[model samples]
Target: EPEVTQTPSHQVTQMGQEVILRCVPISNHLYFYWYRQILGQKVEFLVSFYNNEISEKSEIFDDQFSVERPDGSNFTLKIRSTKLEDSAMYFCASGRDSNTEAFFGQGTRLTVV
Candidate 1:
């Protein structure tokens, strides 16, 4: 079974620094999304991408955050300036369609100091 894979399972960065979290979603999936979970909080949707453009985004996905497909196989989330509140587990998920089951990656834990 194909699955999403994220690099650098954990990352430590200083506040105000930039971080790029990478993910390779399932090959056949058409919709991709980025979500973040603050320590003990619920998973929050950041943004969704389809057909090489942003389909939707939440308020948490402010100007500091950006998503890109970049190529045929990889999806990425870039945080231009990290803040203490940016520390969380970022998950990459994909599905064949919005209504189908989405598969998630192990997630990249980002720590902002």
Candidate 2:
């Protein structure tokens, strides 16, 4: 199975630092999304990007965050300024369509110090 890949399963950064989390979504998929979980908190959707433009985005996706498909197979999320609350498990997911099943990556655990 061709799965979504994320680098550096764990990351430690000081508050206010810049961080870019990388992910390689499924090749044949059309929709990509970013979600996060704050330790024991419920999973929250941050943004959804399709056709090179943002399809939907939650309030959490503020100015500090940005996403881009740098290449055919690479999707990346960048945090211009990391906050203490930014520490969470960032997940990259992809689906064939809005109603289809989405597959999640193992997740990139960001720790802000």
Best by lDDT: 1
Model 2 off-target regions past 4 Å? Answer: none
Task: For each candidate in the order shown, give its overall lDDT on alpha carbons.
Answer: 0.96, 0.95
lDDT of 2 by residue, 7-96 (tens): 879999999999999999998999999999999999999999999989999999999999999887889999998999999999999998
Clashing pairs in 1: none
Error of 2 at 37 (Å): 0.1
Task: Tell me the deviation in Å of residue 5 in model 1.
Answer: 0.6
Cα deviation at 71, candidate 1, in Å, is: 1.3
How far does residue 99 in candidate 2 sit from its true spot (Å)?
1.5
Clashing pairs in 2: none
